[model samples]
Target chain A: MARLGRVLLLLTTCLGLLGTAGCGDDYDGLVIGVVLPMTGPQATYGEESWNGLQLAEADLRQAGTNIKFKLVLKDEKSTPQEAQTQAKTLMELEGAHVLLGSVASSNTKTIAGAAKENGTPCITPASTNDNLTTGNPWLSRICYKDSVQGGVLATFALSNGWKRAAVCVDNESDYSRGFADNFKGAFEAAGGTTHFEYFKAGNADYSNVIQGVADANPDVIFISGYYEDGGPMIKQAKARWEGKPVIGGDGLDSAEFLTLIGDAQNPIYFSTHFAPDAPDEPAVKAFAERYRERFGKEPGAMAALGYDVLFVLMDAAKRCANPKSAAELNTAIGATKNVKGITGLISLDNPDRTPNKPLVIVKVEGGAKKFHSTIKP
Target chain B: MLADVLLDGLGLGAIYAFIALGYTMVYGIIKLINFAHGEFFMVGAFVGYFALRDLGVDEVDLPQPLPILLAFLVAITLAATAAALLAVLTERLAYRPVRRAGRIAALLTAVGVSFFLQNLAVQVWGAGARAYPEPGIWLYVDDLPAKADADYKIRERVEAVVLKGDAIDTARKAALRAEGIERVYRTPDLTKEGKQGFVLLALLLWTPVLWWLVKRTRMGRAMRAVSEDADAARLMGININLIVAATFFLGAFVAGVGGVAYCATYGSVKPLTGWIPGLKAFIAAVIGGIGSIPGAIVGGLLLGVAEFAIPALLEQLGWADAKAFQDALAYVFLIIVLLVKPTGLLGKPQREKV
Candidate 1:
């Protein structure tokens, strides 16, 4: 009984420490901690986002604001745990006023709490996890939420009268889980039945998953994973049995995916954050052109998001009387409206803090994506 | 669903068996797990990929069986031989000196070698899954209509072919019914049926040869002697190091072939692709009596069949998402086998020297 009492006291102390921790901030005129995975499997995402951010910083400085800023770039290594540690070091050590980036949705989710804990405003340039902004006032994102994409896809399924569906989710990924959960919810609410088969990231085989889904014989299949796994899964599935029309989200957007799928004669669809061919307006085209000139390559959706989010952050910071303050920055960001982004118009009027935007649907066939239709929210 | 499960399980299991063979052979000889065996498998795959890419076999727009045969022979042999050489090199540099240096040392060295090979691969080929250059011959359609405008045209053409096949089948069925003949014929999916049959036949043909090589040959005699008592065998004029090197080379050769076959089956290769299958193969080796070659093959088939069949059966039983756990759940078979027959199904229990 004495031992138990001591253990209870220890547990209470630990909980107390946890509850009281992560609520301090030191700010300067402009010190944004830019955390991203510059080297790893997801190094491409970080590099692209960093490139856009660099261009954004250059353009913003040229635009000439009274507010001065210094961006401290840290490599997050593409893991949430790493992002959390990096966020802490940046906030507690570097004295950052705001935090930007960690392109993938899962990485974003990792740093969100760190930002809240440190009382520092965190804005992800490209992460689209649906539940990211649920209760975290200090966390706001510049991309469309995963649930919005899921909801849009759900609407498409309902309108097309595709009642039964199967999903192949990357079980290891938080990004996939959020998208799958939201999709399942929206799908069921509209009276459609959906089932999921899962595989981990880096797992190349999907014969079992395919067998399960094919046996179920769903009307359509949703692959909620990156192109690496999804691409091969589709190819192998087509080899064995006649799979239904497959659908996925932005994770399917990769040149590698097209090559892996390689002449698979299956009707496929995916909803992407942006389509280069279908620019929102003239400014989007102009921004894209400028990016091309600077980067010497076609800008990906991540690059565009990184560039736009920087400008978005500048706009929000300009609105706040004290841009250095985390609370003021958070409020101004949440209150943002009518800001035209390269992807679409950004607004945060909803209590949920999800950006109101349209999702671009593309038909992926024979290693190319053709603009199908934009699903409007 | 059950049949599909069985078929895929067997298919996947075969690859596991090939990978398991290397682990079982190395462990049997030295009582050390060659963790780097999987990396050899991975390297073998890369070898096959690069070979196909460089030979222009996948690109030369060749007519039929010629290109297919060339890819199968050239890629598989090249990959197997290269992997064998790597295995010998690893055994010499990594394992040879550590032969008497305790089991933990050898195991750690194996791990270090594994990491070195994987990172070397990553550096050479930037961390990405390369499309296994498909040699467009036989039934394998490797040409992806990659041109921006070709999407619709190729899709339409492909669809037309399918429709034409369906129409022909329907007409044949109608003719059979009118003639009062009752028989069903399937347009054989040769890619599935022929390929699996070929793999199975190749496995059967080689199993006895492997058994014979171990049981009857002079090198086999030397191997068995060294394994039993290296000092005693060395005193009796057997070259222990040479036999060990030979064993490593042979095991790695088979593993490389397995890797190449995997790429052919799946149409892509990544550095990490072989890791899970490699681990499963180790489990398979353990299940089959880790030191036994015949046991590895049997264990592979058993594991493969179970790996595919369980989740499929579970799904049919309305446990819809059960297939996701199939890979993890495969361990149940290994655990059960270990518990029931600890010496493995084909193993002769090792007696303590005391």
Candidate 2:
């Protein structure tokens, strides 16, 4: 009877210790929601961004900070409706305090509205549309807006003494339209004459419109379309208008364009958030090397923006005394300024959450991109 | 504006006509719409790309005319051979046992085959799009002169006092430089005009070949007989299996040609490259009266032209946002044509007697 009593006491003691261990450590883990296009046409962007976020999470853990992060990943599926649905689910169902998300501008806009309705703080990693966070106080971005990119590309053209410019924009897409408009605005402001032509998205033939532009004798042509149409457009335009410089926004950043042009003599220039040849900070170089090591290829603007957004969010989280509450997190994020990122110094200047970051210009030479200049706003 | 729109439409229409022939031919014989037909086109393009690249044909440094000709010939033969083998295998494995089964079963199999081919392609070739090397020489521009010279005269008063030599060297130099630049500018390595001429030549050559196969030879008679009445023709010693296989081979060969031509025009290939064009071509075949070979050609061309023209026309009529509506134009035309003439433009209505 005495031995049985001792055995029961030891079992109770062990059970009590196990219960305490299951309850976790001293700090309550932080849960941040990530909504992105995990599947679909933009899945590549989502996958790369997720990789950057994972790297940041690892870095934070290695820093020996008491704060532990729990990431809740949701798929946006690259559609506005799906983005809004995912945002709502993340905030309401998942009970996430802060959200990071949405590669495409349209998707970002939709999710931003949802975040605003729920009073949840959301940071978009790669969306460059000018209007997403302009008036919305709850949304933030780590990349430059279309206005900045467009202005920079236009200024570059004018600085190169391009007097007459022709703009070919993707009419069906808001990103193309906004970028083209800002470019035109900046170009005309710099004393350059602009003629605008619009092509519908997925329209394969640009021969007629391009030929018309050639006849008009434009000194430069600005194309605001994704790499799909951009590649073919450059090839067709080069065929018709020899030696004309074709300029574009971040949409033309892909290596696929070089493949499409295939030794064409025309020089193609584009404005993007980051480039491999740009002045590399230690953090940027580390990220680039790590990215190449992991992916067996160079990272693009989306990857850099993704890596920066995570650091920005982490910095905001560190500032808040009560990081668990959504309201407190939003207030903390709104106060972010001059965070040194892989892309550049990111400052959330407007509490309204507009992206006012810097832009980089890159030119395609010899089947690869060479960094030209950086434009600061 | 209409003229420009029509011209643009016609150019695109020509491309669709080529792809549509592949779909119509197979469907006309087998009554099975091969969903994986589009991927054959993709395969052809990649094969052409590798063949040219292996031959060391760079974008800036092209091979001699004979080598290029040999490369294209070899590439086309390989594409046609691969497509034929694939078609036969697809039929034997996926469709043969289920030949007499319901239409739904065949369709389901086709969809399954399409997914299988797509996934296989993705596994073999990475998901990223591959760029095809552009041909280096401009066949049309070789006849043009490399440079041009301009002459300027200087007056000489020989009797009065002095004779002056002409100083037209500077003017001639300037003219030559300008002409040189113009010549360089005018020559594009990948000439769409040249490709179009090649497509026209192929069509002209193949028409007679197809006509002889279908109307003159024993194989053609057997194919026609089998297509008209399979059971009766089988009893009449037509050799149904052989005829069916031959038809598939011929259809796949044509499809391979179409695929190569499409890739040559686009200069880029992707795993999903075939889906849109294939769907459009299938719709073209349906619009042209599903079982008629010539109807498929006419329908495909019309559909391509219509797709291009509608949006351009709409944009000219002050609907500047008409481009967004371009994708829907094909279905709209299909619906209108199907409603107006069930037998199609060139299709004959079959009569049945009980």
Output the number of the lDDT-best candidate: 1
Query: Mind giving the per-residue lDDT tens digits that candidate 1 earns over B1-354?
Result: 566667666777788889888898888888889999999999999999888767756334455456666777898899999999999988876787777889999999899888777766765775556677665432212121222122211221232122222333455445535755442211222354356556666677777888898899999888888888888999999988899999999899999988987776776887666677788888888889889998999999999888777666776789866766776778887888899999898988989975
The complex in candidate 1 yields a DockQ of 0.17
State residue A242's C-alpha deviation in candidate 2, in Å: 2.4
Estimated TM-score for each candidate: 0.82, 0.78
Q: Superpose all Cα atoms of candidate 2 onto the true structure and report the RMSD in Å to 1 decimal.
A: 12.3
DockQ of each: 0.17, 0.12
Q: Each model's number of backbone clashes?
A: 2, 0
Q: Which residue pairs overlap in candidate 2's backbone?
A: none
Candidate with best TM-score: 1
Off by over 4 Å in 1: A1-32, A38-44, A54-78, A89-97, A103-105, A170-172, A198-203, A239-243, A286-298, A317-332, A348-353, B58-63, B92-101, B137-194, B234-243, B316-318
